[model samples]
Target: MSSVNYYSPEGLQKLKDELQDLKIRGRAKAAEDLREARDKGDLSENAEYDAAKDAQGLLELKISKLEEIVGNARVLDETNLDLTKVLIMSKVKLKNLKNNMVLDYLLVAEEEANLAAGKISVKSPIGKGLLGKKAGDTAEIIVPAGKLQFEILEISR
Candidate 1:
């Protein structure tokens, strides 16, 4: 089954651009490599040619997978997002109840998740637990370490 993934406008555009690059420059580079390898003589003993062919195959597979992802992606408009609860594309602030530490995160698609940037994938344990949670609500999320409680402080687009 092909499940659709949500992305912001910028994120969607990045995917499109990457796909275009792979289709154009990436394919061209692979073809050039194959041609260079083929010129190295005797196909039966051409290790370079075999390696080049394998590289091209891997590149094509990557391109195909990217095309599928781009085709199934849906762009989400942040301007129209509902801030009543935590959701994909929502910037959320939470307080760790036990540690009293506050953290900010932007819930996003799996491809867009970056820990340093505070963007967490909705598929993540904390992100999943935060989904549909409103301000003042406490979420008990289970992680690899253990279960932890967080209080939703705010939610914004």
Candidate 2:
């Protein structure tokens, strides 16, 4: 019932690396912390012990999420992509119809989205609305503020 998500090669690799780190180094760190806390004695009253256990639980949750993402992740081969329509990893340039302002954003997964880097999540309202659009197309996206019109100026790999 889980849908597969498309990720760029770099994004997929990053997820794999983080998952490995959490399974290896993260587990080791948690064990060490727990052992050290146990050495301090008084289990029920030991704040350090409680903290370590809480951390371990959080780490396990993170590892579980990483496993799920990796399980459903697919790498997008840029060349094989259809350039005629917008999709994940496509660099889209658009003009704000209201202000005639131009903005360029690369559609990416939520984990890889970084506004400072011009990467926007495909889950975002604007990105979702822009999906499957071509250059010279106009997309009207509904945001928390209201609907905004964006004219696609360019689409590139």
Candidate 3:
């Protein structure tokens, strides 16, 4: 069996929509490019045809990978999430012990992570360290730069 991937509802829907677009419009456009390239010149000397074929190959590979991900994806509901500890989909407020800086982060799946939006992937160093931590608990996370300490202030849905 394939490994199950967790996703939020919106993230899963976005993936499905993208896959649909690639299979429909993307494939059509690729085929059209190939046809146009083939009409341009002799097969052996046609660089455009070769390039088109390469592009089509890459597109098919992307579609196949996306199909696999969508097939195994499980969308998680956030309403019933546990607030006892930091987990996927948890909104956590932390205070940096060393610098006294406060930061907020939402733990989410890798595909749905957007640092600019304050969402961090559970697989990240700080996210992994913060997982299973309760309020007021201190976490000493080892990041790429070095080890940093953070105190969990709160955990919510």
User: Per-residue alpha-carbon lDDT of model 3 for 3-65, expressed as tens digits?
Assistant: 877888888999999999999999999999999999998989999999999999999999999
- The global C-alpha lDDT for each of the candidates, from Candidate 1 onward, is 0.92, 0.94, 0.93
* Model 3 regions more than 4 Å off: 78-81
Ranking by TM-score: 2, 1, 3
Q: Candidate 1's residue-wise lDDT over 38-157, tens digit each?
A: 999998899999999999999999999989988999998667767798989999999999999999999999988899999999999998999999999999999999999999999888
Supply the global lDDT for candidate 2.
Answer: 0.94
Native-referenced Cα lDDT, model 3: 0.93
Candidate No. with top lDDT? 2
Point out the higher-scoring one by TM-score: 1 or 3.
Answer: 1
Q: Model 1 Cα displacement at 106 (Å)?
A: 0.5
Give the better candidate number (2 or 3) by lDDT: 2
What TM-score against the true fold does each predicted structure earn? 0.93, 0.94, 0.92
The lowest-lDDT stretch of 10 consecutive residues in candidate 2 is: 75-84
